[model samples]
Target chain A: MLVELEDVSKRYQLGNLWVDALRGINLTIERGEFLAVKGPSGSGKSTLLNILSALDHCDSGSVEIEGINLSALNEHQCSLFRRRHIGIVFQSFNLIPVLTALENVIYPLTLSGTVNAKARAEKALEAVGLEQLMSQRPTQLSGGQMQRVAIARAIVSQPNLILADEPTANLDSVTSESIMSLMKQLNREQGVTFVIATHDNYVTGLASRVITVRDGELVEDEPSPPFTLQEAIA
Target chain B: MGLGWKVALLNIMRNGRRSLITLAAIVFGCTSLIVFGGFVQSMYDGMRESMIRSQLGHIQIYANGYNQYGKAEPEKYLIPDRDLSTISQLIESESNALVVAPRLNFNGLLSDGKQSIAITGIGIDAEKEVMLSSAIRIVDGEDLFPEDIEAAHLGEGLFNALDVQVGDYLTLLASTQDGAINAVDVQVMGVISTGVKALDDRLLRVNLPLAQELLYTSDITRMVVLLDETQLTDTAISTLVSAFEQHHLDLELKSWEELAGYYHQVVGLFNGVFEFITVIVLIIVALSISNTMLMAVMERTRELGTIRAMGGTPRQVVSLILLESVFLGLIGSLLGLLMGALAAKGITYAEWMMPRPPGSTQDYPIRVFVVPDILFRTFLLGFAISLVSSLYPAVKASRLPVVKALRFT
Candidate 1:
């Protein structure tokens, strides 16, 4: 198993009211599987992704990645584990404004002390079709191009798993299609596992496997059928 | 530079206006410290040289019991002429010694035939006295010459009190060593001012031979030794002390510092004021830096979260903030030092005059000296304040929660 979650639960306090974000979630993911988590707003999709990325801890039960119990790791250890094994993509693209696209992509590789980080970053940007825009800062790049750079940064280190939260929410439909196509191509060719939390039906259609969450509970899990642009607009 | 320092530099550059304001505060603090410190140091230097040249030489050698019993029994504490010659020869042998002059102190009545006034008198070797009393200004006539045995130099105030002009004749009377009164007639050769009111009011200077004749003694009061440099005073004293010990002479030595009580009091006051100013500057600079760093952290909350999510440790985040502050400190202090040095040079070249100080009768010109030690210390202080001031903000930036920070607008 690439990832395992057993009886995981999470709660948050909002102005003296405790909201249960996740409840007793049991799930398993195999290596190289492109999985999509689908839910409505406040359905705990983000909280689940937060736990999977080790950005937050569960209130109960255990989380394991590659047989290493993430629940047993402290904050510092979790940070090291995230740096060494996991890559995260955000909804907003989160590129450092002061750095060029190439420097932003090289950031994770540098943090991991990888040798020849510049070459690796260039190769990653090339894989995402952004080699021509390597020297451009985020402000100069379009929303779709920025998301491509974020994806390049995520996969630069060749981690075991990549988690993206609402990765295509800011892009238009045409640009979203191109970004999704790029991610699908990387998954097929490089065999990097992907777990994405999003509300878009089009993203669900592109996933190899789809899981639906509602009111902090998993409601459905199954294989996804092939999706087309005409079907998405319809 | 590491990634942290690079990011810090870029962040500082990105917020150019804010950084400039922060740098201005640091610059002002550093400049104040350097200029004020330099001014105080110049005052100390001027005061020290004035005291040394006017009354106290580098060192004074006295016969045994002179400081304790000389006032009550002047004859008992007198250094005989034989001992004076021996001590002068020993002192003059040292390479650092410039002049060894013998002096006799006495008090008597001076009369210009019609009016008589009580006066304090100094009997000195005329040529050596010129070297030791270089700070004394002669307002009328010329200094006493060794060949003019019956000539005296009256203080400007004393000359006016006696209504005597230079070249006028006067009579000096004092009690001799055996309780008998003796008198001598001398010509006033010069009028001197020491910039002190009380001293100039009763001051009188005469040749050693005349003083000995009037007092009926061939013994001197003390031997004043001037050195080539004030820094060499301890070395000279050590050499003289060894010589005195070898010859078994009964004498005691006092350096200029011990004899100048007023100089020490002035130094203490200046030092206290300097320290107080330093503390005030430190607080102001620290507050300014702290506020700047805090604002930087606030503006970059999501960016910091991105870094943390990309596996940057809390320690790395803290290092980044502190690195920015250090760079700010280094550059600002250097600029301040440059500005302060230029200002000091300008003031010195302008030749500004200060009003008369307490116990002084004449105004003195102000000169600001740029001391390397003061510059170095002020730079270090500014840099240290910057680092310490950023610590709280750095730690606060590091402790920011990654989830909430990412979610921050």
Candidate 2:
């Protein structure tokens, strides 16, 4: 198992009332799996992704990645582990605006103290079909190109797992299909596991397995048909 | 360049106007410090050299008790005539002594035989003094001849007060060594100004022979020794002291700094004022830099969060911010030093004359001296203030929580 969440629970204080963001969730994901977490708005999917990525704490649960307990690591160690093991993509395409695409792709590698990061980042961008746009800043690139750069940054470090929250929420349908196909291709070719949280069917339809969350609890877990960009759009 | 410095450079360029404004404040602060320091240094140098030339020589040698009791009873503590020649020869050989002049001091009443006024007089080797004291200005008549015993120079104030002119005969009366009244009849040779009100009001200068004759004494009060330069004062004093000890002469040496009490008071007061100004300017500059950096940190909250998510440590984030401030400080200080040097040169060349200070009778020209040490101190101080100002904002940025920061709009 690459990830394990055993009876995780999380709460937030909203004004005077306590709101349960995650309630008694138990889940497991193995290595090289393409998993999608699907739910409506306010369904605790983002919270689950946050906890799995070690970006936030679970109030009462065991969240482990590759046999290492997420709760046991200090803040600094957590950042190191994230850089070494986990990569993340966001809906808004969180690329450092000041850096060009190639620099942004190599940012994670740089933080991980990798030498020859530029060549590796260039290869990653090439994999995303963005070899020509590597020198362009985020502002200069289009929405699809920016997302591609974000994906390149995530995989540039060759992490074991990638957690993307609403990765295609900001893109149109055609661009969204292309982003999912790229992730699917990387999962198959590079053997990198993925856990994506989204409401878009184009993302969940492509997943090999889907976990549905409603009102901070997992209500369904099931397998789906294998998805391809041509099948989803047609 | 390291990633920290690259990020810092780019961020500084991101907010072009704000960064420039902060830099301007630092440059202005440094420039003011350099210019003001140069002006004060020039004043101290000018006053020191003027005082040395006008009255106090590089060093004064006197009998042990003359400074304490010579004014009350001038004849009681005079250096003996035989010892004076030996000490003069000793000083000339042991140090770079330019002029070793003997002086006698006396107080008496001077009259045109019809009107008499209280007066303090010095008997000097006029020819030697003319060589040593460039500050001596004769306004009306030629200086007294070295061989003229009957000739005297009346201060401008005293000349006016006594209603006398050149070639007038004056009688000087004083108590002799044996408590008898003795007098001399002399001709006023010239009118002179020393720029000191106290010295000009009731002062006169005459030859050594007449002073001894008027007071019925052959003893001299002290010896004034001039040096090649003011920097030679301490060396000359040390050499003279050692020689006096070797020869078993009863003498002590006083440098011009010790004799000029007013000069020290002025320096102390100006230093205090300059220090206060420096502190105030530092506070203003520090606050300006802090405000600009804080705005920068606040605006970049989301970007900082992204960097953290990519595994930037807190220390790295803080280093990035501080490096930006160091760059600003280095550039600003260098520019300010260049501007200040040019401004000092321009002011010095303009030859602007300042109004006479209180109790002084002549206007002094304004001159700025840009000492290298003062420039270096100003640069270092500005740099330190800049770094200190960045610390709080850098720490604040480093402490931002990752989740909240990323979620920041």
Top model number, DockQ: 1
Question: Under CAPRI classification, how is model 1 graded?
Answer: medium
- Candidate 1: tens digits of C-alpha lDDT, residues B87-135: 8888988537888898999999999989899999999999998999888
lDDT at position A171, candidate 1: 93
**Which stretches of candidate 1 lie above 4 Å from their native place?**
A224-234, B109-119, B148-151, B154-173, B181-190, B196-198
Tens-digit lDDT track for model 2 on A1-234?
A: 899899999998899999999999999988888899999898999889878877788999899999999999877887888888888888888888888999899877877679999999999999999999998989999999999999999999899999999999999999999999999999988989999999998888878789999999999998654434434654
User: Model 2, B133-159: lDDT tens per residue?
Assistant: 668678788787778879998888888
The candidate that wins on lDDT is 1
For model 2, what TM-score does chain A reach?
0.95
Give the DockQ-based CAPRI class for model 2.
Answer: medium
* Models, CA RMSD each: 3.2, 3.0
Residues A67-155, candidate 1: write the lDDT tens digits.
88988887777778888788899999999998899999998777767899999999999999999999999999999999999999999
